[model samples]
Structure formats: C-alpha cells, structure tokens
Target: MAKDHYSVLGVQRTAKPDEIQRAYRKLARKYHPDVNREPDAADKFKEIGEAYNTLSDPETRARYDRFGSDYRHYASSGAGPGGNGGRWGPRAGARPGRGGYGNVEVDMGGDVDWEDLLGGWFRQQAGGPAQGTDHEAELWLTLEEAVRGGKRTVRLAQPDGATSNYVVDVPPGVLDGQRIRLAGQGGPGREGGPQGDLLLTMRIQPDSRYRLKGRDIYVDLPVTPSEAALGAKIKTQAPAGTVTITVPSSSSSGRRLRLRGQGMPNPRGLPGNLYAEIKIMVPPSLSKEERKLYEKIGSVSDFNPREER
Candidate 1:
C-alpha cells in the first residue's frame, strides 16, 4: 500500500495547518528529486504534492474528506446534490466523435463577468476586424501539481442565463505568470473571421518551505550549532523532496549553499540553481548547566560581523 501523505510528512492526522506545512517542508527537502537522485524520488514528490494540494485548501479538503479521492469524479459527473453537482453551470453534453470526445458543453449565464468574456473582443476591435479575442485567466497550482501535470475544471459564468465549465490541462514546467493558449477558445468569430484564442496564466500556490525568485528557488534550512562548528553534510528539503548538502565546518548563519540547475526551468530550456540559506539554531530551552558550559567556551574566537562596514 502507498504511504499516507500525513505519514510521509511525519505529521499527525489532526496536525494544525502550520504544523502540516512545516512537516512537508522538512520532508520535501530531504527527498527532493534533484538532491537525492533516487529512482522513485520524482514520483514520491508528486504524490506528496497532490496530497498537500487536496488537504491544504479548506473547500477542496472538505470535499475530499466527505467523498474521498472519488469526490472529483462525483463533482464532474454532477452526482452531488442540487442537480448541477454544485458547479457554476451545466454539465457537459456528449463528447465529440469516437468514444465521446470534444462533446462537452457549458451554458454560461448572460450576467457573467463581461471583462473576462469580452476582453478579447474589445482588444480585437482595436485592430481592424480583430482576430478572435483571446481569453486570459490565472491558474493556481501547488508545487507537486506543477511537477505532474493534469486536467482541472474551472467554472465561469456566461453572457446567457447560464454557466460554463472548461477542462484545462496544466502542463509541467508551467511557471508563474506563464501563459497557456487554447486555440479558438475566444469570442465568436466576427463576420466570418476566425475564432480567437484563450490565454491562461499560471500562479503556483505559495509553499512555506520553498520560495521562487525568477527561475531560481530559495529555501532556509536549519542547522545545529555543533553541525555548523564541525562541518558536515546536512540533509535538507525542497519542493521536490530532500537532498544532502555539504556544510563546511566553521559555517555561520546566513550562509548559502547552491544546487546547480535545480531551480525552475524556463521556456528557453535553462534551469536555475537551488539556493539553501543556512540558519544556525541553538536550543531554545537550554538547561542551566548547558548555559554555563556555553559561557565557559564563549570567548574562544574573536569574530566581528560588522567589521566590514
């Protein structure tokens, strides 16, 4: 049997939100695919990511808890109460051709967000007859979701007295602010003009363990004071899971370790580095004897941080 996500992260079933996040970060750093190079590391990272995505959000988590993994099937099939599966609009009709593909349809209400629906229309009008207006929207993803791309259904209100739902594929390496185009998904063709396109931008959900800067990823890792004093290979975590990094002895807090080509990959096919910022931590609840020992050894070195200034 597959390990439970909660178990993989080493958290209790009732762990608080922050606790769950902390656990995930710690584990992610330890097993990240780039760092470990393990055969199944990528798959493990993806599994944890899916679990976190489902459990992290209140609404989505509630649905999952109520209906389990199969809840999505129920949601899409309009199997839930209230006729329309509590969706924004109507269920899709038959798919087109063969085994029923491209046959799904949605009826968006007339009072739908005009800007969302007609932004492309106005933009097209600006340039002569305008090629079909292109639609744009943001897609929020978790770290794991980005690694293992899949389909997502989003609901939109229409100009008619109805709603419309679209199934979109979230491809891998789709970074934040990146756009995915759906051909001919724009406003109706004007006077025999070709249909426009729909542009969907991506925004990954924030993770407490990982921070992205452009294509590079940064993470703060905790290290013991002793480990910093006596350089060691410290295991750390990332969105892809965990990896071990060498920490030269005599390292200090705020030191950075680099993992080449481990950061986000861009459209140009260039991958960025992964930076691990070290934060040395002391025991918060030290006993009196431990404090005395520290004081005895305090004056061993003369290091001044502000000397450079």
Candidate 2:
C-alpha cells in the first residue's frame, strides 16, 4: 500500500512547514536506517527521507499536494524538485551512456561565457583561453570512522592508466552526508588560472549494533526477567568496550538507561550520551524445579498484574 507522507510522519496534512519538519525529525530519529535494523526500517527511512526532501521545499510540496503519486514522475523530470534530477534519476534528455549524480552536466545559460567562467574574472575580461573543467569524485566512510576520527587512504581512479591514493584525515565529530574539500585536486590549471577543488560527498556506512539519533546512541540491552525484577549490576558491551551497567531494582522492560558521554561527539567537542533500552527475556519453557518454585511464589505473592488493567 502506498503510504501517506503526512501519516508516515505522524502529522496532519494541514500541518505547517515547521510542524512537518519537527514531525520528520522526531520519526527520523526513531526509524533512520543507521539506528533501526528491523526489516522495514530501511524502507521506512527511505520513505521518510523522500517525503522530507519533497515537503521541505515549497515548490515540490505544492506539486506533491496537487499531483500525489503522479507527482513523482514530474518531480523526476526536473520539475517540482528542481536541481534534484540526480536524486530522482537522470534528466529528461540524459544520454544513454551518460552518468549522473554529480556527473550530470548542466547548461547554465547561453549568456554564460565558458572561458570567463573557467578562469578568474581578470582572464574573462581579457578573453582568456577556455579553462579546464572541474573534476568530481565521491568518498565513502564508515559511521565509526566519521564519529571517532580516523585516517583513510582513497585510491583515485583517474582516466589515465595511473592510479594514486590520497591519505585523508577525518576530524572527530563529522556528521553523515557532510562534504569535504581538497584544494587544487580538481582538473589542472587552465590558461594560468588555479585548478578547481576536489569535492567529496560523504556517505557513512551502516552500523549493525548501534543507532545514531542526532548526537545520541540507542542500543537494545537484553535482560532476564529476574534481572528486571531484582536489579543487578551486570557487565555489558559498548561500542568503545565492555562496561558494567547497573539495572535499578524492580525496573521494567523498555526502561532506558543513560550512559553519559558514550555516544558520538558533537561539533562542540562533547560526546553525546548512550541509551540502553531494556528488553526482558522470558524463557518459553521452564524446568520442573523452576515451575515448582514459580507456583509456590505465585501462591503466596498475590501479584495480579492484570487486576488494574
């Protein structure tokens, strides 16, 4: 079934722009693929991302409300979400062999002077030679690498037979989808103009064990029913390492435990907190002795959990 974008974000169709953004942020923090691993999480995240990308822009939002599913075709045709042809797919007249998504060539305007645009304005005034075109490339990184800061060596595949690797040092606290730049790494200088920069669009790898929400990290921590009932300090593993966590006595399942400074760091250089959500494990079968003990305890305990409900 096609999902209603408003319903997916838990917002009414009449929701204001800010309201829609807030709803998306709230739900995205919950179901983002990096944080959620349920079978439907990735689909849900993509849906949410698509919805946000469309509704966040005024022109696209207007067209979406007017056209609904049919709007997608229009949106992909370089209408509605203008300049997003790469995200939606190739442009209307893209060549069969042409690539997009940073490879799409745009004709700025007939008035645009190629030689002037390529070189500094001085060269343009003097009618200098056509400048070298800017080269584009992509770089992928892991979530942990983006968070903890690490060094990466990327092998650049140039058109020529020669291949070279560039060592890149990623700073701590980098967010997903953030771009980095390398000066003078683009096409060589043309007509005495300096070479353009190399732009790196980052794509963070998916994590299996951790989910990042803004600056917070959430992990499901399994606990035995007894552990939930009569709390104990048990050792648990964190992304960094193993650490002992104390489950408060009489705690219930789904209780969240906060570990300060255990999450991804922020731009301010302070690490975010980690949240452990408790899930009580109940064995399907019980031993004879266990059953007998439970029966005896039930006979004396008068714990009718359903009485109130």
Candidate 3:
C-alpha cells in the first residue's frame, strides 16, 4: 500500500502550505542522511521529501485528495477526477473482454498521450532534456582558514571510482553549518539540459587554542604572577597573527580582556571581538633567592585570600 503523504509528514490532512513546509523542514533536519546515521534514516528522509513535494503543491494535493492512493495511476490513465469510474477501476458501462479483463474502454474523451501525462507529472518531457539533480557535500575548514577566506581545492569522489577536483571560493566569516552554492557544478543534465548546482555545507574543524561563540572568540591567555600583579603588555596569538595585549594590574584568573574587532573578520558587517581570559601561572619550583623574596613579601603583607568576603 502506498503510504499516506499526510501521515508520512506527521501533519494533518488539512495542514496549510506553511504548516506542511515547517513539518517537512523539521523532519528533514532530523532525518537527513548526512546528519542521521541510522539504517532507516535515509529512507525516512526521502519519504518526508516526497510527501512535502506532493502536499506543498495545490494541484497535486487536490489530485491526491480525490484519488487517494491511486492518484498517480488514475491521473496517468487519462481519467479526470470526476470520470465515470470508482477509484482506478473501469467505467460503469465497460465490458470485460477475453480473459475477463483483456479489453477495457477508458473514456478519455479525445486522443491522449500517455507519455506526456506521466512526464508532466514527474517534471520531465518525452524525448526532451531534463535538468540534473542537485548535489550536496561537506567542506571542512580550519579556524584560520574560516577566518581568512580563500580558494580551496575540494576533491569529490564519483560513483564510478573516480574523483573530481573543484576550487571553491570560501567567503570570510562563514559560520559553521552555512552552505555555499556552486552554480551548474552538480550532476550533468540529460540530453544537454542545464546542470544542477552543488551545495557545500561548511564544517569548521575544532581548534584547541580557541572556542567560538557566534562571532566572538574566547582564548586562554597565560600570564605570569608578576605580570598579573603588575600591569604589563603581553603578546598573544589571534586568528590572523600574534597581537600584543595589555593586562590590568591585580588581575585574577578568569578575568576577560576584550580586543575589539580582533576575531573573525566579517565582510558584510562588523567583525567579531576576541576575549582573552586571564590564567595566572606560578613557578613550578622556586630557587632560594625567589623563595626568600616571596617569604619577605609574605611577611610584609597582611593580605589573606582565605578571609570571608
């Protein structure tokens, strides 16, 4: 039995176009083969797309609603929805020929082209070129590469044990999960039709030194105890290059210093800010002179960090 389109999309039969579209998008995101690894996820995703394609269109929805499961069969048979037939059976006055079903007269009212009917429904033309299918692939980029956009060579494996290389132009400040489209670079069209597009989903590789949150970047800045106690200018790493930053006096761990416009560069708008989180480091082993100096300072100072706030 053909699955019900409404049931496949988990939407009511009376769902509006926007409601159906929303359900399709939600299900598609959950069941997309690229994101979901379950064995049946690909099938479920395809089913959802099919349901959306049918229900989203007013004409297709009307046909499906009238003919139920046999809509395609009835439509391709040159029988209108109001034809003198029950579902997909023959007309009321039709007589069974030899073998009880050999000859059946279908009142098409005029000369009908079966090929044209089926082809039109499937978005194809008889003896004509057809557009190719669009393709999607993931493109992984390092944090540095994402920050500074450039041309990258992408190698895609074909089904026939061959590979094709394409140079992709990545724009700066492209967020993770964003898509870049390459026009007419997908599967070849049939009979010289226009080729489809290739969509590349961006996947930013993780970096140990930094963490990204939207356009903002967070990085741990290791500072000596002396530097923290007394304000000092220090050099640190940024996405583009090393930059000198100022450390405030008496700064503690976890204190963030903001460097405006030092993060991911945005070609469209304002650049992101880079935050340097302070992490004070102490000497592993102190020499005799250092120990004496610390002891002297400890004796002179009456400050107690363990005191109640």
Question: In each prediction, how many residue pairs overlap at the backbone (N, C-alpha, C within less than 3 A)?
Answer: 29, 1, 0
Tens-digit lDDT string for candidate 2 (87-198)? 2323322345543223444544343343334325323333344333344445676666776777888765342323467777777767777777877776555467677566
The segments of candidate 3 whose C-alpha lies over 4 angstroms from its true place after superposition are 1-129
Highest lDDT model number = 3
Error of 2 at 152 (Å): 1.1
Candidate 1's residue-wise lDDT over 129-151, tens digit each? 43544444556788757644679
Best by TM-score: 3
Candidate 3 C-alpha lDDT tens digits along 247-267: 999898999999999988888
Descending-lDDT candidate ranking: 3, 2, 1
Whichever of 2 and 3 has more TM-score, that candidate is: 3
My TM-score estimates for the predictions, one after another, are: 0.51, 0.54, 0.62
Candidate 1: which stretches are off by over 4 Å? 1-132, 147-150, 191-194, 205-208, 299-309
List clashing residue pairs in candidate 2: 35-211
In order, what is each prediction's RMSD in angstroms?
Answer: 19.3, 15.7, 9.3
The lDDT of model 1 is 0.63
